[model samples]
Target chain A: MKLLYFAWVRERVGHPEEEATPPAGVETVADLVDWLRARGPEYAYAFAPGAAIRAAVDKRHAKPEASIAGAREVAFFPPMTGG
Target chain B: MAVRLQREPFDAGAEAARLTQGREEVGAVVTFTGLCRRGADSGAPLTALTLECYPEMAEQELARIEAEARARWPLADALVIHRHGRIRPGEPIVFVATLSAHRAAAFEAAQFLMDYLKTSAPFWKQEETEEGTSWVAAKAVDDDAARRWDEG
Candidate 1:
């Protein structure tokens, strides 16, 4: 799977995108976030609990419970501020 | 309908004109432009605003918003253009134009598109000041504004 970060999430994670493979039990966006958080302090900071992070699965807005099964891309970012 | 995500600036007048040109059937046209401002929350002078977007996802999300407006309103046409990259204060950042046969539909649809865009679009803004740069936090007011459309 390809993971993307944006805004401050990207800054904290130190990169915009990356490729990673989650274990079989990582089935939802929340689980993936938890998996990434364990990778390093940076990921932990970016996906810290209570952070206002939003996620997308394959470019569509996704809830935390949204399944990531067979997904190719997932993006995480702060809430959008566009107008 | 048109959704353009560009790095270059856009002219609101030209965009509005393009939507209404030669269309006598269009009785109402509403155009809105959002601009970068010189003030920051900390009372620091803002130098510029950097807008970042997920290239492919931004386009798809914008098209989805435009399509929703079209489905909900009796719109003749709608155009949305949002700019990404560093924008100086006083520069236009986004433009939305909607056309319809009646004033109510045109006005409401344009507002609907903007409200949704503010909260749902895949774009983030960072403000630069002498102190430093920081991401603009999403406001609860914006979420409330978007949520209003869901109620009667």
Candidate 2:
């Protein structure tokens, strides 16, 4: 799956997008975030539990409990402030 | 229904004219244009605001919201145009217009579009200030504004 980051999350993660294959047990967005957090310092910082993160699965806004089974794209960012 | 996401600046007058042109049945046209401001809340000099979005998702979300506006109201047509990339202070950020047979519908639909777009759209904004650049946090007030429509 392709993971995209935006705004400060992108700055912290150090990349706009990347392809990653999470371990088989990771079936939901929250689990994926936990896995990503363990990968590196930047990922840890960006996906920290306390961080005000919002996500989209395949371009649609998603909650942490949302499944990622058939998703090809997952994006993470801060809450939108656009008008 | 028209939803356009582009990097080029648009003329609000021209866009509204295009949407309302040749529509004799339309009695009211309500238009709202959002502009980038020079300062955020810090009172520091501002230079620009960088807008980022999930390309395809942004258009889809805007269209979905516009469709909802059309469904809830008796609108002749609805239009949404949003600009991405770096925008300077005073540059137009977005434009929304609704055409309807009554002023109430036009006004309500336009406000509805703005309120929903402010919260649900997949776009992020970062303000560039003299002190330094910072991402503008989403306001709870915007979510509350959108929630009002849900109550009905």
Candidate 3:
């Protein structure tokens, strides 16, 4: 699966997008966040607040409880401030 | 529904003109322009506002919003133009134009689009202030504005 990061999340993660496959139990967005936070310091910082980070699955807004099963792409970022 | 995410500044007059020119069915056209502003938190002097977007996602989200507006109202047409990258104060940042057979539909649709874009769009803004750059904070009022559309 491909994952994307934006804004400060992108800056902290040190890249915009990447491909990764989580372990067997990492099935939900919340689980994914916890797993990614354990990957390294940068990932840890990016997902620090964990729940504060917003996410989109397959280009649609998704809650943290949403399943990532069979998903191709997921994007994470802070709440939008666009007008 | 025409949605564009570009770094180039768009001519509002031309865009508004193009959207309603030959469409006689469009009795009203409402346009809203968002401009970069100087200073933000702590009163630091802002030199520019840098906007960032997730290309595919931003486009998809915007298209979905446009589709919703069209479905809920009798829209003749609609256009959304949002700019990304560095934008100085006084420069236009975004433009939304909605056309419908009557003024009420156009007006409401435009406002709805703006409210959704403010809270749900995948765009981030950083203010390049004299003290340095910082991301703009989201406002609760924007969420409340979008929530208004959910009621009867």
Candidate 4:
């Protein structure tokens, strides 16, 4: 699957997009986030200690509980307020 | 329909004229202009807004949003103009216009385009404030707005 980052998340992750294969047990979106946070310092910094992160699955905004089984792309970013 | 991703501020009247040209089925026009804000929720003094995007991805995503709007409404024309680079307060940030056979389609199409853009577009904005420059975060309200569209 392709992972896209935006805003500070992209800055922390150090790239705009990358193709990746999630590890075992990373079934849901929340689980995948936990796995991503454990990847490295960049992932940890991007996820941060306690910041509100928003996500989208294939360009559609996704909730934390949303599934990731069929998702070909996933995006993580901070909350946006642009009109 | 024209979807433009540009760095220069757009002229609304000119853009509207461009979209309406050679089209006779368009009976109603709805337009929305988004401008840069001077402050965030904390009321910090803001100087400018710097927008960034993934060049290839931004264009593809915007095209998807416009296509979805057209599928959902009977629009004769749709125009989405988004400006990148640094913009000061009161400067235009984005413009969305929908031309349809009736007011209802135009109105709904405009709203739908804006909602989808808020959630799906890859544009990122950083606010240069007196306190310090900060990257803007996606709001829960925007997620809620986009979610509602799925239910319809």
By TM-score, the candidates rank as 1, 2, 3, 4
Residue-level lDDT of model 1, residues B1-152, one tens digit each, is 99999999988988787779999999999999999989976678999999999989999999999999999999999999999999999999999999999999999999999999999999999999998998898999999999999995
- DockQ of all predictions against the true structure, Cα-based: 0.92, 0.86, 0.87, 0.36
- Cα miss at B96, model 1 (Å)? 0.5
CA RMSD per model (angstroms):
0.7, 0.9, 1.3, 3.3
Which predicted model would earn the best TM-score? Answer: 1
Candidate 3: clashing pairs of residues: none
Name the runs in model 4 displaced over 4 angstroms.
A1-4, A14-32, A48-51, A54-75
> Against the true structure, candidate 2 has what lDDT?
0.93
- Residues A60-82 of candidate 1: C-alpha lDDT, one tens digit per residue: 99999999999999999999998
- Which stretch of 10 consecutive residues in model 1 chain B shows the poorest summed lDDT? B10-19
Q: Of 1 and 3, which scores higher on DockQ?
A: 1
TM-score of each: 0.98, 0.98, 0.96, 0.79
Candidate 2, residue B63: the lDDT equals: 93
Residue A44 displacement (Å), model 3:
1.9
Give the CA lDDT, 0 to 100, for residue A41 in model 1.
98
**Number of backbone clashes in candidate 3:** 0
Q: What is the interface RMSD of each candidate, in Å?
A: 0.6, 0.8, 0.7, 2.6
- For TM-score, candidate 1 versus 4, the one ahead is 1
DockQ of 3: 0.87
Chain B only, TM-score of each candidate: 0.98, 0.97, 0.97, 0.94
- Residue B113 of model 4: what lDDT? 88
What ranges in model 1 sit over 4 Å off?
Answer: none
